[model samples]
Target: MVNENREVTEKIINELLHGKICTDASAFSELHRIATWTNPYVDYAYVDDYSKKTIAIIFFDKYNDNEIIKENTVKAISEFDMVVDAYDVHSLNEANFYLQDITRTRLNALPISVIVYDSNGKVSPLNTISISEHKATKRTVKEQRSYWCWWRDGSHFEVATLLELSQKYDDEQGDIYTNFVYPEFFNLMIEGKTRKWDGTPRVKKYSTSSYKSEKQNYKIPMCQLGLWDVETGHITHKGESVLCVIKRYGADSKEFFDYLAKIILIDGKHLDLIKDLEEFQKNNTELIPESSSEFFILFDDYMTQKNSIGTRKPTAQKTGAKKAYVRDEPKLWNKLGIVKLQGKSRYYKSYVGIEFDWDRINEILLADIFGGSNEKI
Candidate 1:
């Protein structure tokens, strides 16, 4: 499905470049719509510069193949430099990231505002698209980064230097045999190497706890933590507190319960916890009812001092939390594979809900992460 989307996108790009899709306000708008369907994270806007020249504004978020879009945009910019003025490429995550700074228009908006920036530096809006009016029902790109550092040995260590030293040990061994080196000597060696890399003191001043936290928290690229109801076909949350929802609803919904169990097995790696949860369900079925509100109460009760271990936060913390979680949200859970919410019968007002399409989501989840081994041009 990713391949199919890419193929469709490439074809559209070719047509647009070759004048097959006549370059006009309407044409660009049409292209923007098509690109959004292909990948909502990629958006386009028309910018009429001070000289009355029209340029295509391409913006990319963390999601989708930003690198590919960038390469294509660069090529298109060069091709259209003389033909359609100059194309501008911008990163959504970086600062000064918008074409029109006055309105603070987000790049993700569909039919993104068509505005003019004059030589006097005055910004004027030509075509407007309201961010409030259009509500994004599906999971959209929340963040982006090129690389993430991980401990090579897979040992879960919280301290930054400890993890880095561990990472170095595993990395240095790379295909070589492991060793049991003296702790003092190894620490000295690591300190020397660290100082040499940045010409800093052997004992680094700042805390790397934040960096280590980011990597260990299971927040990986392109992960979706959103939870959807299997029967109602509604997304309970979009990349939010899904574990809480699962722990609450797992007993009642087989689909939700199964996925939650798998995640706990894969992420928590605590067979005993799963056993306890199953046991609890069997023994106290009436206490921990199947309803969503009841589920929340049961989960809270399960978190008390007596059951601290079971109540431990799932590796995937709620959105906007300080620390990260165990592993990326099961990519499969992101796709409920059904049409989204048709009504609020099962909607939780406190939490946002998105409609799900099971078949469509399955296609997306099953698609190759690298989009079918295609080489970057």
Candidate 2:
């Protein structure tokens, strides 16, 4: 669908660069409500500067690839360093106060304010056509750099990091090698030598637990932890993400599950815990429900308990309780960590999970500790 406002904007920019141009203010004021089929939401505005120059503005759908529009719009205004502008879907119904500062104006209002600056003495449609061709060259001339941002998220650790990330599971340092993140921690496990964090080449060292109960736990590990990619701007798990270095190899479900669960519960509170729970079940298809009634009730109780903690001093302790139960014990059996609310003897919130030895994820090892490969840029 043709964005009439944007179309008018292009026309206006073309004219303003040519010379002084104006529009009928009364004609725009007549429309009641305006929108475009491409992406509904009449969020367009006009901006002006202290120098009395005016500009038309519009928002776009994130996926909207208005190649010509962006190129031409940038080209139309490029010569005028007097006015800086941008188009994005992020701002909606927000007025550009400088133009005439008042949001009462709707987006359907066309032929918006004047273009105040014009560096081009004889810019024409032909030049606007050239904008696309020259844009890449122009951008390269501008300063640029590449920074490797997030590649994985908490989800990645379920497979590797849980082995080493847990401060409480410090006793389980021996088991960290099996951590899901292990494979990717040192250069995607692609082609590099693992190094100690202190610039030293590294290798795994074995451990023997003094506690007999520890012997009953899973075998010790022999790998490293890694990172996952997050959204471009958001810094936390709330945004969309995926496994990065951890997935350089295949995946380990046990580690993946543990990492994912921690992230969901870490925030403590969000829009609705139940909503996240539902999503969890939908994503991890491995979980089997042993006790539905108890699980639901405890989940609600956990929600209440989670909220109650705010009134008290902050600490890892929650209402003086820990959740730990085996499936055959009782329907109302208690478990600890975030899954304390489960009804079954064994309470797992979702099918996906990391096989945490209930003790290892938090262990701190004083053994001749070794680091892995250095992260490359």
Candidate 3:
């Protein structure tokens, strides 16, 4: 079916090129309508025998669907041998604006022929095609703050261990995990020296290839948090600063938690828990759930409502949210003393509700850490 459609399209293009108007109303009617349309953009390509290149005729109209325009532009480049783009614009100002666009400016370096199109759909072609050069605009990277690592079982110690190994070994090497990380983990496990932040002995199953793929959970979050330089496998200055704080004041200390909160919130690269917390506080002032399990139910409900409004990414599933917010983030916070866990046991199934330290939370939210200097460290 697709091949037949392509063949028909090719036939239509050939007919149009040869100035033989297609008589098939069902197939060629759209082409004639496009040529006469005052606003809709048209893109057609043909080979130039002299240059042995394919030339793309792009009819630009501001009223056309941007996505369609982009798709047609890309299609012309990909289907052709070597694309020499010719833009049809209404005025000089429109041409200038199109050339200034960061994405569109890339086509400026290609040989371009300008055609003036009036409101009446009359085409006036230029005598000379110009090959010009323009500086490409630098695109800014957008900072995203969602879809965090959902590895609920691992702690900061494991993360620290990975960072330490990355510093000694080049991450670019394929054998870094097999040669370094797994061996070190094996040594730690055998010695019975594996411990959590609070000096608690951590016993877990280990294998040389256990974390080969799982390591991405740590790597992605560490890079997002500005802790590790994944490219170089070295601790960034930000990572170094965090390590210093950990050395001076233990991981369980308030100082360490404060630093974590600052980066997690201010950097805006992980979960937007602060915003969620604020929204929860605003709506449920009288009946705030204290238990982690209870809180999870309410948070899930809140997310359901939020999702209905189409604010979140399509991939942000309820299960993912539960892992990131309910299990992972809360566990970290509880360990660092950012949010105190009450009850006989700190285990998820048995533990009492988490006690929110509003004063500290408020203070952390209002902190001006990056007010003037933008010093992440």
Candidate 4:
């Protein structure tokens, strides 16, 4: 019986390698034969194109007992770039176990990681799932795919297989965007020229203030703030999102700019500016030199007062002066074309501006500095 079982297993393995049992039904038949070994010489069997070059055969029986046959087989197959577990069964009774596992896993599709930047300049991670797919084409052979994100209605969502969701994102032709309307509505879509459809992202804005009022808001991790959506595999921000927040509140008052300062350090896109703030935060003793450039001087005062409240002297007056100076600085940078500052503001002061042109500063921002003209702010 054992000899017969070994012969059957070898034949099945050969057939798998030769692509004879590639379909789900044929693979199951082969696995069943190995599982029904009379002397328990075979444990399980499976076939897949895990090696990339061609189909690979994986099987186990009582003859191999030195290592975990199942675990080793899975690990080996997973190492390949593309693989599909065609069939696996440990015993005759467990013939349908593989199908059941697939069903269960699909019900809870992989958790997606979404990092959102709040108005307060902090980053928070929100896990969202691909809930459904919107058909982008009617053709039978080559259908286009699109996906709908699981709505963030403060409820747990069940996951399921939505292949089109992946295909639509993969087919993105231009820059994608993630826009949050104040507090509730959050949208993600590809930009106009590169977008395949004419769908507007302005969905109904949800009201979460009541919920927020009841719960304390926790700060998001600073590291996850950028535009990358790891779950969907896309680079999405298309406009001046948090920058608008800064422009509105940054220079409004000392209290507001202080908050904006923190936001910039925590979630700012400009790599150099973020580093400067982080350095200043680490070393509070370094005073802003009088001869330093204007931006540095203003930035130093901002950091010194923001981080070293109790330790620094003349807190009130210094803070006040720095606040007054910074309120008009964004306007100056705008007039000099240092940055494409979008909002409206006025600078009534009359003095000779700094001798150098401020264009170099535009290079540092969360957005791509030299992006195509079609790209958004």
Q: Name the candidate that leads on TM-score.
A: 3
User: What are the per-residue Cα lDDT tens digits for candidate 4 across 14-107?
Assistant: 4443444332222222221111111111232222222212122233233232134334433433332112222222332232343344345552
Model 3: weakest 10-residue lDDT segment is 31-40
Backbone Cα, N, C clashes tallied per candidate: 12, 44, 1, 3
Candidate 3: segments with Cα more than 4 A from true spot: 1-151, 170-179, 207-217, 230-233, 244-257, 268-271, 284-294, 307-325, 340-355, 362-377
Q: What is the per-residue lDDT of model 2 for residues 131-163, given as tens digits with 9 covering 90 to 100?
A: 111112112212111010111112232223333
Residue-level lDDT of model 3, residues 35-68, one tens digit each, is 1011112333333323223334454442233344
Per-model CA lDDT versus the true structure: 0.30, 0.27, 0.45, 0.27
| TM-score pick, better of 2 and 3 | 3
CA lDDT, candidate 1, residue 354: 24
TM-score per candidate, chains pooled: 0.22, 0.18, 0.45, 0.17
* Winner of 1 and 3 under lDDT: 3
RMSD of every candidate to native, in Å, equals 22.6, 22.1, 17.1, 26.1
Ranking by TM-score: 3, 1, 2, 4
Query: Candidate 1's residue-wise lDDT over 1-377, tens digit each?
Result: 22222233334344443544333333332221111112222332121122222234342322344344444443443322211111112322322233343235343333233332322323333443323233222323232211111111211111123222333344343211113212432344346532321234344223366334433232221121212222221223421233333344432344443343333222222222223334445555556544445544453355332222222244335554423221222122232222344354342212222233444434433333223322111
Off by more than 4 A, model 2: 1-12, 20-57, 60-186, 189-377
